[model samples]
Target: MSTSITIFDTTLRDGTQGEGISLSADDKLKIAKKLDDLGVHFIEGGIPGSNNKDIEFFRRVQSLGLRAKISAFGSTRRKHSLAEQDENLQRMLAAGVPAATLVGKAWDFHVHTALQTTLEENLAMIGDSIAYLKRKGLEVVFDAEHFFDGYKHNPEYAAAVLSRAREAGADWLVMCDTNGGTLPGEVHEIVSAVGLALPGAPLGVHTHNDCELAVANTLAAVQAGARHIQGTVNGYGERCGNANLCSLLPTLQLKMNYTCIPHESMAQLTNTARYVSEIANVNMPVNQPYVGSAAFAHKGGIHVSAILRDSRTYEHIEPEKVGNKQRVLVSELAGQSNVLSKAQQIGLHLDPSSEQARKIIDRIKELEHQGYQFEGADASLELLLREATGEIDELFTFESFKMLVEKTAGGSVVSEAFVKLNVAGESLYTAAEGNGPVNALDNALRKALIPYFPSLRDMHLSDYKVRVLDEQDQTAAKVRVLIESRDYRTAWSTVGVSGNVIEASWEALVDSMRYALLGLHSPQPVRTEFGQRGLVNH
Candidate 1:
C-alpha cells in the first residue's frame, strides 16, 4: 500500500472566489456531494461567518451524511476579543462542522500592516483560536498565511507563529504561499524549516499559482514532509488561481507513489473537473491538464499516426485513465492512417492504403486551404467520411431558403424563415417565426423534415459556437459554427463553415441532427446513466 495524502478540496471556498463564479447554497451542496462521491477526504465548504450563503451552505452540509469531513474556514480571533466571544468563531461553531480551519497572519509584515497589530498580539490570536477550537472538540487546521514570504522576511517570527499553533494542539499547520510567488525550490526549503520547527504537528501545503507553479510547489512541499494538500478543483481562485488538484492529484498518485482516492475510479478526474465547471457555469478551460479537451487530442499527421500505432508515443498516460478519449483530428497535416483510424472509430470503414483514402485526404487539405477546419467541425468530417465510403443515404436535399428579420418599436426582434426541401421526389415547403433568423430557420427546417423523419423530435440544439476564420473585417469574416445536440441517450457535435454566419450555423445544425438520427439507427451499448457518465466516451 502507498502512503495516503489527504485531498483538502477548497472548491466551495476559493473556487467560488473566481470572478463571475458564484454558487448558490444548493449548488454548493450539489458540488459537495459530487466531491464526496469522488472520494475527497476533506471538503472545505466555505468561510461560514463571511456571508449568509456560506453559513447556509455549512448548515445544510453538516447534516448531509457525507463521508468527507466538512470544514468551515475563518480567520483567527480578533486581538481584543476572547476566542469564545469572537463573532467569527461563534459563527463557525454554530455552522456545526466536524472541523474548522482558522487562518492567521504568520508574517510579521501582515500583522503590523494588514492586521494593524503587533507581532505578539498576532501570535496570541493564533494560539487562542486554535486552543478554543480544539477545546470545543473540533479538529483544527491552522493556516499560516504568507508563511513562505513571512519566513523569507523574518524566519524567527514565522517559526514562532507555527510553534504557537502547534503547542495549542492544531492538528495540521498549513503553510500558505499566499502571494503565489514562491518557487518549488523555495517551497521545499521553507516547508522543511517549518516542519523542523513544529516537529509534532502534521504539515499541510496551500499554494496559489501566480507563477503557474502551484502544482509544482505543492509537489515539492509534499516531498519535503507536507502531508496534506489544499487546492480548489480546476484551480479556480483569485488572481492566477489556486493549485489545481486535477493536475496535482494525478501527479501524486501516478508519479510520486502517493495514494489519493481510489485508483480504479481515477478516470473520473476529467469528468469531475468539467462537472465543477458546468455547475459554476464557467467555460471549461480547453488546455487544463488531464481534463481539457485538447489534453489527448492528436492533430499533426506524424503525431496522429504514431498515436494510432501506440498511444503511449504521444500520450503521457492513457486517456481513459482520466475519463478522456484520444481524438485524432482531421486536418491538413493528417496522414492516411490518421484519417482511416478516425473514420473507423466513427463506424466508417476505409482502406488507409487505398486511392479513395488518398483522395479524401487531398480533398481535406484542399478544403482546409479554403478555410474549412475539421477539428472543430467533426460532424462535417463524419459526413465526408460516410460519403467517401458510400455509407451515406441521401434522405433529403435542400432546394432553396430565405430569411427576413424586423425590429419592433419595443426593441424586440421578430424573424421569419422559409425553407424548401426535396425528399423522395416530393417538395416540402415550411415557414416559421422565432426570436432570431437562425432560430426561425432551424424551426422551419425541422418542421419541413418532421413529416418524413419523425425521429427529429428527439433532437434539440444544446450548444452553438461560432468562430471567425479570417482576421479581417467582421463583415468579410468567414465563420465556422459548431452545433451540439442530444437525443434520448448520446450527444454528438457537428461543424459547418461559410462566409455567412446563418449558412454556417444551418450546415452545423443539419449535420448535428443527421448524426443524432444515424446514432439512433445504430446505437451503442448502454454504459451508465446520462448524468453519471463522463463527457469523453472511451
Candidate 2:
C-alpha cells in the first residue's frame, strides 16, 4: 500500500455550512489558489447547481489551473431512480471537474428515517451513482455517510455498502463520522476491520467535531491503514465543525512523518489558515493549535527566559515550520527577560540589567494594574518602551476635546465632536459628526491630522474591543479599549484604559495614530533589532 496520504479539503463546500460563514465566488477562488499552492490533494469546490455562488465558483475554477483536483460534491442518485436521470448527479457531471464525491446513506437509521428509503434502494443509489460517474471517466469518491455508526449498529450492512461501492469502481471508500460521536478507539477498530475485510482497497476518513474528537479520530483512522483524510480549513462546518485540516496537516507531516503536502508547502500552513479565516470573515480562535496567534506565544518570565535560550524548552515544534513565529508577551507576570525580549522584538534595544529595562518593567506592571493589557496590544507596548527609553517624542499633545449628543423627539440620535490640537507649534481646530461619540471623536481627530500626514489617510481601524475591568463597579467601572489598525502594508494594535468609555477609546485611538506617525517620521530602519523587516504580530 502507498504510504503517502491524500488530503481532501471541503472548506468551500462543508465550510460554508458553518453559521456566520459566507464566501463569494471570488473568495472561493482565492482560497482555492492558496490551497493548491499549499499542495492539498483535492479541493472540494462545492455542490454545483446548489446555489448561484457555488455554480459561479465551478464555472470559474476551471481556469484557475490549480494542481489539486477539483471535486464536485453531491449526493447519490435519488432512491428508486436511475443515476443517469438524477438531476443532482447530472449537475455533478456538468461541473466538468476531474472527480466526483457522492455522499450516500450508510447508517440504517438514516436510511429509514431521513431518506425514508429501503436498504436495497439506498445500496442501489450508492452503486448506480458511482457506476454512472465512473462511466463518464470521472474519479468517484464514495462518501459512506455515518459509516462508523452504521458499522457499530449493523456491521454486516456497512461492510456490504463498502463492498458495493468498491465493486462499482469507487476510487475512495470514505467512512464518515457524520454525527461526530465516535471515539478514537472505535474509529481505529472499525477502520482496521474494514482494511482487513477489503485488502488493497483505498480508504479515507471524514469526521466532525461534535465530540471535539474529529482530529483524534482522523489520526486513529490513519494509523489503522486509512490513507485519505477529509477535512475543512480551521474545522469550519455545520454545528460543531468538520475535522480541522490546519491541525491535521502539520501533525501528519511533522509529527507522524507522513508524506502529506510537499515539505516546502508546510510553511504556508499558518498563512493559509489565516487567509481562509479572513476571506470567510470569521475570527480564527487565538488558542487554536499550530496556526493561532497564541499557538507559540510564551508569557511567563521563566518560560520566556528558557525559550530565549532554547525554544525547545517551551515549544513542541518551531513555529516557523508553519509560517508562524514565537512571541514573548509582556504583562505583570513578566521579568526583565520578557521586557528585553519584547524590546528587541520591536526594534528597541534594552540591556537586561539596565535601568531602562527596570523602568519599563515597572511601568508595564503599573499600567497593567490600571487594567492595561499589552499581550494583544504590541503597538501600545512599543510606544511605551520608546517613551521610557527616550527613543521617541510625542507626536501630538492633547489640548482638549468635547462631545455633544442630541436626541430628537423622533428618537433619532446624533453625536458631534470638536477637537483642538497643536501641530508643529500651530493651533488647529476641527469638528465632525458620527453615529456615536467615539466615532465622532475619531473622525474629528483624523480630519485635523490627515493633511499634515497623508499616509494617515491610508490608516483605518479594523477592529475595536472593550472590556470592563471590574463588573462590581457596574456603571462606573474602568474599561479597557483595544484598537486594531492597518495601513496598506502593516497592521498594529494599541490599548488604553480609563473609567470613561469615550476616554478609553480616545486614548487607544490617539496611540494608534501616534504609532503610525512615529513609524512614518522615524529615521531608523523598519527592521527590528533581530534584523527582521516589517511589523511582527504579537
Candidate 3:
C-alpha cells in the first residue's frame, strides 16, 4: 500500500503575487475551476480580506460546486486582538469558504522583530486563530510560516508551534520554508522531528525556491512522513517562487511510489500549466520542468537519434505521462529524422534519402547560420519546405519597398511606406502611413495583398520579438525577429534576420501571412460528407 499525498494548489493565491500578474475576480474563478478539474485536492483561492477582487473571487467560486475544497488564505489574528474579533479572521469567515489557511510566525526572529511580539504571544495567537476558525466549521490548516529556519535557530520553539496547532485541533499543520533557503538534509531532519512531536496531527510542507531547492526540500519532507504538499503550478510566487507541484507530483507518484492525482489524469499537467499562464497573461517558461515547451525538446543530432531509438536513453520519463509530447527541433543540428518528422507534421511527404530532403536540410542549416532559428519559427520552416519543393505558387513577388520615418517637434513620430509588387504580369504599387516604419510597411503590404487574398483580414500579428545577434556595434548589428501570427484558430511563428531591422521584419511578416493562408486553403478529406452522400445514394 502506498501513501497518498494531497496536492494543494496555491497558483491563484500565491502565483498571482508574481510581479506583473494581476488576475481579476472572474479570472481567479476560471482558473480555480480549471485546477479543480485537474483534480487537485485543495485549491487555495486567495487572501480573502486582502482586496475586493479576492473577496469577490470567493463569492463567485462558491457557486462553482468544485470537487476540491476551496481554502481562504490569510495570516493569524493580530498580537493584541482576540481571534474572533480580529478583522482578518472575520474576513476569512465572511468569505463563506469551507476551509481556510492561516499563517503564523514560527520563527522566533520574526515573532520578536517583525510581529513585534514575544515567542509566547505568537504561540497563543497561532492556537487561538486555529481554534477560532475550526469552531466556525471551517477546516483550518495552520501554516507554520518560516518553520524550517526557525527549527534551525530554535528547535524547541518550532516544535512548540506544531504542538500548539495540534492542541488547537487544526486539520493539518503545514511546515513552511518561507525564506526558501533550507537544504534537503535539513528539511528531512526537521520534518522527522516535527512528525514525532505531533504524531496525532496531519503534516504538510510548503517550500519556496530561493536556493532552487523548493522541489528537493518538498520531496525530502514527504519522505520524512509529511503527507500534504502545498505549492503552485509552474512554481509561481513572489521572490524566488514557491515549490512546483508540476515537478513534485510526478516525482512522488512515479519515483517514490506515492499516490498523487489519478494516473490517467496526470496527462493534463502540461496543458494545465499553460492554461494558467494563458489566463494570467504571462508567457509560459519554455524550459520549466515537466510542462515547459523545451522540457522534452530534442535539438542536437546525437540526442535526437538516440531518443528516436529509445526515448529512455535521454528522457527521464515518458512525456505523454505528464500530458506533454516530445519535440524534435529542426535546426542546423537536426538530422534526417528531424526534417522528416517536421515535414510529416505539416502533411508533407518526402523521401528522406532524396535530393529534395537534402536540399531542405541544407537550406535550414544555411538559414540558421544567418541567424534564423527555426525552432521558434516553425511557420517559416514549413514555408521554406513548400517553396523548396515547388509546392508554393509564386502568385506575387516583391520588387522593392521603402519606409521613411520622421519625428516632428511637439508631435508623435510619423512613418510613410511605399511597397511595389509584381503580380500577374502587372505592377501594383501602394503607400500607407503609420506610427512606425514597420507598421507603415505592414499596412502598405497588407493593402497591396488584401485584394488578392481576402483571408489577410483574418490574419494579425500575435507576438513580435527582436534580438540583436551582435551587440559589439550598436549602430550596425545583425538582428533576429521572431513573429507569431494567428488566423482564427490556428497560430504560427516565423523568423527573419538581417542587419536591417525593417528587412528582417518584412521577411518574417511575409512568411507568417503565407502560413496562415496555407492553413486556410489546404484540403482535407471529409469523412462525414462522404458517408452522408453514400447513404443518400443507397
Q: Considering every candidate listed, which one attains the maximal lDDT?
A: 2
TM-score, structure 3 vs. true = 0.89
Tens digit per residue, CA lDDT, model 3, 37-150: 788999998887788998789888879999999999999988878998998999899999899998988989889889998889999999999999888899988899999989
Evaluate candidate 3 by giving its C-alpha RMSD to the native, one decimal. 6.6
The deviation in Å at residue 380 for candidate 3 is: 1.3
Q: Rank the candidates by TM-score, best first.
A: 2, 1, 3
Instruction: Point out where model 1 deviates above 4 Å.
Output: 422-427, 448-459, 486-491, 520-538
lDDT score, candidate 1, position 388: 80
What shift in Å separates residue 220 of candidate 2 from its native position after superposition?
A: 1.0
Q: lDDT, candidate 2, residue 74?
A: 95
lDDT of 2 by residue, 306-342 (tens): 9889999999999999998898899999988898888
Candidate 1 per-residue lDDT, tens place, 307-335, comes to 77888999999889878888888888888
Q: How accurate is candidate 2 locally (lDDT)?
A: 0.90
lDDT of each: 0.85, 0.90, 0.85
